[model samples]
Target: MPAIKDSRIIILATNGFEQSELEVPLNELRKAGARVDVVSLKEGEITGWDKNDWGTAVKVDHTIADARVTAYDALVLPGGQINPDLLRVEDDAVAFIREFHASGKPVAAICHAPWLLIEAGLMRGRRATSYHSIHTDMENAGAIWEDKPCVRDGNMITSRKPDDLGAFVKAIIDAVEENASARVAAE
Candidate 1:
């Protein structure tokens, strides 16, 4: 596996993110030695949604208005019913995701986070997976939905739900290391 020690990752989210969805990758990626930032819609912090209610608050490292896509190697979008739904409507959030995906960097969208991908116009002809609840929404947006734990197509890494996070994170690290290797080769 990749250590990802030199990677700079950004987790873009707002309030109501899935608790484990954000926390797991953040902790695991950091343990792999990556510098991870939790970028939200504002400063201070953002709260996550747990099983039945609001969960822990993750500190905000930066806001979407202040972040630049070129500064990071990958982007993680954690999902909950509310997080992506709210973010997808924000013009800045959608635009940033679009630009980042266009840059060909790894963009991981777990569960409902795929909604952001749809809003960014990135799902056309892409193979992906997401929380079962959004199957129709995903298909309508032009994605080829697969019923798997994780689906990696091109630069997009997506997962079905929390139980599939292990595979999701692995795919992300693999993509990051692969992209890094490609860049080094080109140089």
Candidate 2:
């Protein structure tokens, strides 16, 4: 896929985010020449959750209070049981995501991160996928749930789990590039 050289992507996460899910896509996006930012509920650093324990800490670039949906071309939500679970209840985080979705920009989530989509009420009637444990939650929230590695419906992209990171990241890049192209054509 082509690189989103000038696109700006934001990964909205917090402490307890699945380590690989957040790091892999963040690295991939930056490597593809996109400017990626990590936005969380608080300032400073957010820690990650490794397989069975707490993992590395990542610097937070922006807090939900200060992030603007219009400043980014895409939004990513990385999943870990605690991360999304915590974020779903934070009104600022959910509203930030909702505004981003309404902007028609690519909004991608992996694993349990789709929980935020459910909270934001953006999954209704959209085709999506997430960690198996949340399949019921997603379905109940009105998403057409699938068991695929990656699924893209309009500007929303979702993936099953860490194993699907490669495909998930690729899908996000593709969506951002497509959105960029469309804007250029419109201009």
Candidate 3:
């Protein structure tokens, strides 16, 4: 992997996203010189789910209808029970995830965000990890489920929870910096 100063990453989420899951990777990826956009269903702001209640509102940089998959080097999905649940049902969101992954771009999902991957049909026969509660979901999606902090299979990455954000963020940076062909060969 080379320097990622010019890498553009999309952090796709919506209302009820887990606070740390979105913020940690967004801030860290930016600090590492990657351009990250908080793309959502709408253009205003989306509130996060801290733990039990609502957290801070994160500005939406672009709407799903407007964001082009070709414009980004990677996609990051932040998880919370409600976040992925809401996103997986949106046809546009699922199409974006599928097309992004099919293009061989990096796609990282943490916690329950793998639900979106499941919706995208990107989990079959892949090695992955997610929130313990979603182990069955992953298995049902044909993913080789594990309990690790971070699991990287080809250009896709998955982690257990906010506690695994460090590894998850690092994985995305690595994936972005790595050669696209190399990632496909890694599959």
lDDT per model, in order?
Answer: 0.95, 0.95, 0.93
Tens digits of per-residue lDDT, candidate 1, 1-187, equal: 3348999999999999999999999999999889999999889999999999999999999999999999999999999999999999999999999999999999999999999999999999999999999999999999999999999999999999999999999999999999988888788
Better of 1 and 3 by lDDT: 1
What would the TM-score be for candidate 1 when compared with the true structure?
0.98
The collision pairs in model 1 are: none
Least well predicted 10-residue stretch by lDDT in candidate 1: 1-10
Q: Count backbone clashes in candidate 1.
A: 0
Candidate 2 per-residue lDDT over residues 1-187, each given as its tens digit: 3449988999999999999999999999999999999999989999999999999999999999999998999999999999999999999999999999999999999999999999999888999999999999999999999999999999999999999999999999889999988898788
The TM-scores of all predictions, comma-separated, are 0.98, 0.98, 0.95
Give the poorly placed runs of model 1, Cα more than 4 Å off.
1-3
Model 2: worst 10 consecutive residues (lDDT sum): 1-10
Candidate 2, residue 65: the lDDT equals: 92
Candidate 3 lDDT, tens digit per residue, 106-176? 89999999999999999999999999999998999999999999999998999999989889988988888
Highest-scoring model, lDDT: 1
Clash count, predicted structure 2: 0
How far residue 133's Cα lies from its native spot in candidate 1, in Å, is 0.8
Candidate 3: which stretches are off by over 4 Å?
A: 180-187
